[model samples]
Target chain A: MKSREKEISKIEEVLIRFHRRHETFQAPPFWTERLMARVRGEKMRGNGFYRAGAVVWRFASVTCLAAVLLALYASGLNVETPYEIVELMFDDPAGLDLALLFASL
Target chain B: MAHSDKETQDFEIIARIMGGDVNAFELLVERYRPLIFGIVMKHVPYDRVEDVAQESFLEIFRSLGSYAAKSPFSHWLSKITVRCCYDFWRQHRNNPEQVLSSLTEDSQQWVDTMLAGRSRDAFEREASGREAREILNHAMARLSAEDRMVLTLVHLDGRSVREASDLLGWSQISVKVRAHRSRGKLRKVISGLLDGRQESI
Candidate 1:
């Protein structure tokens, strides 16, 4: 038992020494440059994806907005000014009355 | 005080990186490369250290946004490095035989000495540092990814169970259990190697 303990202690010591010995490595002078270059490349690739997604989203949003405008034009609901829309909303007495009731409540 | 100051500086660097100053990232990589490389070398094969270290840096960069700063940035980076090492082993689990067969002549000799049950003094006198590291690496390669990560962090790197638990995002009990199991597995691998050497003799 004593011998086994001694052997284990020796193994532990050797392993610890080994671990400490290998702890620090001299990184090459070009390491930072190489890593930065890779990071830049990755950023560019990521930007490509982001740009593509932005294009798609912008296209979808514009398409939706154009479609809504076309639908409103087809329905003859186009108003030239904000006042006209406000006048149209107030033209409904029931909505005005409901708004007044809610305001009071 | 120094710790918080470093943390604040890291946060500033992170902010700059997030604000589209991509060049600021070079500072982070420069600061942490040695640390990441050291952690990686504990598990990565010698030739593949650079590749794995680079992969860890890229991974850190990609995942930087998710860092919440609840823990120290270094601890979080250590976790990522450990995970990359685990992934390296997972990707190569089936190739252990190939790896073992590629051990250098010096490592093989060291293994033979270990198998002979040489005394500690004899090992100290005879085994070169490279041989000792290679022997440990060989034994480590045979372990499971979890075992390798836990053993490297807790045993080889001299981290406490709590620290390892924090880094691994595992419970303290889980870290303790894994550490125990990993140590057992490592001992078994070493013993098996010694036995194989004896039989070959």
Candidate 2:
């Protein structure tokens, strides 16, 4: 198998080199401009999509966060103030609001 | 400046492009035109090779900012080139004749000159040896895309079996085994063609 592999490689190399040397080279030079144009077009198109995605994600996030904050504001579950909520975990035995939040969701 | 020197200058241009300077991407394109074209020609038809090659370069530019820089630049470029050429093949799957057009005339001329005794005589020292290879390429075209890609990536491109495996995202064992199998298939086809050629002769 090794010898045969080598024989095949030798034959292929000769054929390729022969093909390469005799092949007349021609590729349209203007393709550089064409390609660059396409690149720029795609870049613009991608940026447009990115901007649109950014807007959607931000709106969704802000809306969700705002809904959470607004619900908390509306609930009026004041033991006293916003700082009182932070202390609730450590001190407040009351778990009623937690149950209410889950039930609402 | 010399082409290589100019090409080296492109790294700086690429750095800027990666830094969000879109204009610098053009320099990378101008610098690597022939290299990308050469890679494309290996798989694409002779006519559509240029645009497809250009598409690869654009993909490289658009995505370069996310590149990990762990791999060699050409390997990264070659990955995109392979993918773009595959896309070209997919679009042209219904018609193989439209593969790559930029080099159709030259390629036809190339085939004509090759099949004739004119170019064969140059390798007269090894003319008898050349017949098998021409047959091999013909046989190669008949293989499935998966087979053809594994064969080209390993054999024609001189990539390591491991590297070819990595490029194609197959296990190294699979690459080695598939490469071995494809060679047997190629040899069988070449032998068949040789028998037919000899009978005609």
> Which segments of candidate 2 are over 4 A away from where they belong?
A1-25, A58-61, A71-105, B1-12, B18-20, B94-137
- In candidate 2, what are the lDDT values of residues A1-105, reduced to their tens digit? 664455445445554453343233366867667777777788788778878998999899878985686457445665566566566644536656556665787
> Mind giving the per-residue lDDT tens digits that candidate 1 earns over B1-201?
246877888999999987778899988987787789888877787778888998999999988989998778998998998888888888887874545544566655675565467767776655446777766777776677778778888987889999888777789998899899988777665555555555666
DockQ of 2: 0.21
Indicate which candidate wins on TM-score: 1
Q: For residues A34-85, could you state the per-residue lDDT of candidate 1 as single tens digits?
A: 8889998988887788789989998998789756654454346566676775
- Clash tally, candidates in order: 0, 8
**How well does candidate 2 match the true structure in TM-score terms?**
0.67
